[model samples]
Target: MSDTHAPTTRLNKRMAELGLCSRREADEWIARGWVRVDGRVAGIGVQVAPGARIDIDPAARGHQQEQVTILLHKPVGYVSGQAEDGYQPAAALVQARSHWRGDASRQRFSPGQLRGLAPAGRLDIDSTGLLVLTQDGRVARRLIGEDSTVEKEYLVRVAWGEATVGVQPLVPPAALAKLRHGLSLDGRPLKPARVDWQNPEQLRFVLTEGRKRQIRRMCELVGLKVMGLKRVRIGAVTLGQLPLGQWRYLGPDERF
Candidate 1:
């Protein structure tokens, strides 16, 4: 006997696949009667065939447009997420008083902007630079999701062994090559990275993966000690003159 299951999928999943919203958001909209299938309101867990027509209420789109993304020039000492060991989280710096005066965007600071806003990616307590916090789930998923291929660029200060007279304390070319490809952390090989020297004391790393303390660990593996690490860019967005401990809105035209 032949099997006879139709190729159907959950309504929420289909909505997410269509870039309308995330599955969770789709469920919320469905519960709120903001989603429709074949011109009728959809219900939670509803499944439909491949040809089903999905419609989202215009109000849902407006609400999504109001969601905000913030780019913080995080200073060292604050954890990226929750407060830990008495160290404040970077989100605490997003208050109105802390808004960057140099911000060219017309967006105004509001208390409601803080609600549900969360860090999209992490910056180690000891490191500093561009850190993203957002209320938009789509932006978070785009930047830190499992399949995200966004590149994060960092400038890391390193120290090799103490310099001796007539000798340089620099990482060898062979080791630098390894930083570009050959390395492992947590018993797994790392993805290939773009590692190059920015100056005598610093290395510029462009990586697609953000493992825990990853840059520091990568430097350690190459026999270099990371003295300071600062993320300068995530995808096309840059830290670009945003003063430390201040934030600015991700502009309308900006992506990633």
Candidate 2:
């Protein structure tokens, strides 16, 4: 007899949890007979139990390969997502005119590529540097998923005590240690971060979590005020020499 008490979840949800695709994409693949579970073609909304084998058709894989991921050197004043308070979204800069001439990818600019392209993570309007926009759900999920462990690196210029531009005050070592692992925000403890002095004026930070205004808030808690913030790297990818307000496709050999 079958174990009727076994827990089951929607096939699309299972696919999403497995990093296969977004739930919507999973539903589309199922409708197109591109998904198989336990050696049978899956249907939309099909329920799956633990350890159930799942497979994807080659056609589905081909479609996924066509989806694109774009890396942008975002400039300050542009919001990472939708337009708000008169500031344009960063996606507006993905135009052909703004495509980096040095982009090594063979892919050319196309209007269709913008249809579903969206920022995978937020880069505050006041902050600048690397911002990722992608049409591939897999890329989005991998970078910003709730359980994601990808490291985001930033160069932060901070002021201690009074606000004096270009003046670097001596920070207590205990405070620096707190910035690395002992801070909490919104009443929740923060994950340990890699924080160190890049220069007398700038601090280099590497964090696996992205909380809203997290770095800035952490600095404030440690008696430091952030003057400027710029994200430089995410996972294995760096902003590199991508010019400000320009974008480039993620190369075929690139991951993360």
Best by lDDT: 2
Question: Model-by-model lDDT, in order?
Answer: 0.88, 0.90
**What is the C-alpha RMSD, rounded to one decimal, of candidate 2?**
1.9
Task: List model 2 lDDT by residue over 67-113, tens digit each.
Answer: 88999999999999999999999999999999999999999999998
Candidate 1, residue 94: how far the Cα is off, in Å: 0.5
- Name the lDDT of candidate 1: 0.88
**Every candidate's CA RMSD:** 3.2, 1.9
Tell how far residue 256 is off in model 1, in angstroms: 1.8
**Candidate 2: segments with Cα more than 4 A from true spot:** 1-4, 163-169
